[model samples]
Target chain A: MCTMIAERASIQGSGKTENAWISIDSCDIYYDHPDHVDSEHAITLSFSNQLDPINSRISLEITPESAKEIIRKIKAALSKGDSLER
Target chain B: MKNYKTHDYEGLIAETIQFNSANGDSINAYFAKPLHKGKFPCVVLIHHLPGWDELYKEFTRKFAHHGYIAICPDLYFREGNGSPDDVAAEVRSKGGVSDEQVIEDISGAVDYISKLDISDGKIGLFGTCSGGRHAFLLGCSTDKFDAIVECWGGNVIMDESSTNEKQPVSPSSLTANFSGSLLGIFGNEDTSPNPKQVNEHERLLKAENKDFVFHRYDGAGHGFNYYDRPIYRQEQSVDSWVKIFDFLDNKLRS
Candidate 1:
């Protein structure tokens, strides 16, 4: 199915493309069909610089379980950083 | 099954052409047809949401092989040029293309094909996935098409919450207006138009007394005919193709 489900947000970061590291402007998150992944569907985190070409964007297609675990690890790491600062 | 004669000559011509779409915007399109001289039915192919990529080009040529003049317009042409996947991802992020714009582009294809001297003036619409949904919508919106082949079309029954400025109305709502013969192909395991949704779609069409036939395959999911994906089911795909050709023959050829 062509799920038109997607959400976008402006973000501040830099990501490396084949050319070089470019300033990323926005990100889109969606759970839909994968272009390369073998799975039927995957949660995709796509980072892009609006000022750059479409191909310059970076993307990660991961399973739902993988996405959840990554979120958990991210929160844990952030909590550890706060504790260390305190 | 009848086999081709040993001395039969088969030839095809395929090329990319640019034409004006909605709002007079020029866009790229692929056209394929048999080289032999004969009045042929035309098929306007609405490419799936994955964008107008290589697979659709192959599909256009396949129709040409089967003696139809086929044209597939690049709906994502206005989104800026890039690789098909890149452009598709961009369109996906932007909530897909607007239903109105797509209708105009496909209408442009119809106009282009209709003008050809070789055309028999009978046109059929074929599409899969979101394209299928569009095919259903176009068939209902106009009397131009003789047949519509909708394969695994999702969002034909869009809920109110799914409605956006792009796709504001559920196509199923126009079931009463559908006048063309329709052939729907679905996979039982698909979720978007899961069995329940497919049932509801059929119910709506039935209520309108529409002329349609639906084929549901067991053990197959969405895009079962896409050989590039792991979900491709060879047996189901072959059977569905047979059904499609048969349906088109009855609807457009007869």
Candidate 2:
């Protein structure tokens, strides 16, 4: 199974950074990037919403751990003051 | 303190009005107006899935108290309501009314407002639940609306298969075509519009370079705007009302 993470943040003031980590299905995606990244660069995790065989609905589930990791990356990007890649 | 009815709010007076829709289906609508009104900006209110009821009436009155002429047309004319439970049961049993019918009824209401001497021709749209979905669709289709507020609408993004199967209006597709400013208020606990759906909507809006605002209230469930409903969240409702008024005032007022 593949996991995805999407994070976005709007920061206020300077010299302060916020970190967030997100864990989903026992896999952790952490966001610890430096603060130099622009706030507009949101981290996105894209996947298909398709299911095979059974009639179970396909959904994208986000766990708090994964959210935290994405937030951490965002804060790191902001702190480093660099453009984010993806 | 004595319990006052919702209509007892200051600066509002409720009246029943009849309007003709594009399909020539006569629509019965409730009009809420300010006590001192002469050429005030108006709002064409659309009701949710179960159709027009007391909750929608109260909402119109509240909007009237805020100085806008709020007209709520009966979207479900075929199935009349005996009670709230009846409305809910009907909605669950019959799914949803056709989107084309909704747009026709809304257009009729807009026409009614345009012909009114007391209206300034500027109109905004607001609705909850299914009505919210209609508001978004109508707002996207018409340039007449200055502002639109949608609360907890569902199935915003539809798959190609679903569209082919049901032929329903896809709000996700409509977002890119929206020219008016939109305000979407959703409950954090609304499973219909999960975080993923919300994010998808945001992404579409951003990609299309559309102007919009989305607010998700924590600890609130679906139908938080209805004061008498079980899912009502008083604090969030109050806050959302404030934001709605501010948005309307800024956009609709000349």
Candidate with maximal lDDT = 1
Instruction: Show the colliding residue pairs in model 1.
Output: none
Q: TM-score of the candidate numbered 2?
A: 0.69
Reference-based TM-score of each model: 0.96, 0.69
lDDT per prediction?
0.89, 0.66
| Interface RMSD after interface superposition, model 1 | 1.5
Which residue ranges in model 2 land beyond 4 Å of their true spot?
A1-86, B1-10, B164-167
DockQ for each candidate?
Answer: 0.65, 0.01
Give the CAPRI rating of model 1: medium
How good is the docking of model 2, as DockQ? Answer: 0.01
- Over B1-254, each residue of candidate 2 has an lDDT whose tens digit, in order, gives 12247886456779989889888999689998887747788998887654577778888887887788889987766555445333433333344467787888899989888777888878899987767777888877878788898887766666675453223658789876787888989988776566677788779988999879999999886667666645568999889888888888888885
Worst 10 residues of 1 chain A by lDDT: A33-42
User: lDDT per residue, candidate 1, B1-254, as tens digits?
Assistant: 12358798888999999987856888999999999988999999999988999989999999988889999999999888888877888999888999999999999889989999999999999999999999999998999999999999999998898888999999988899998999999999998789999999999999999999999999998888987767789999999989988888888888
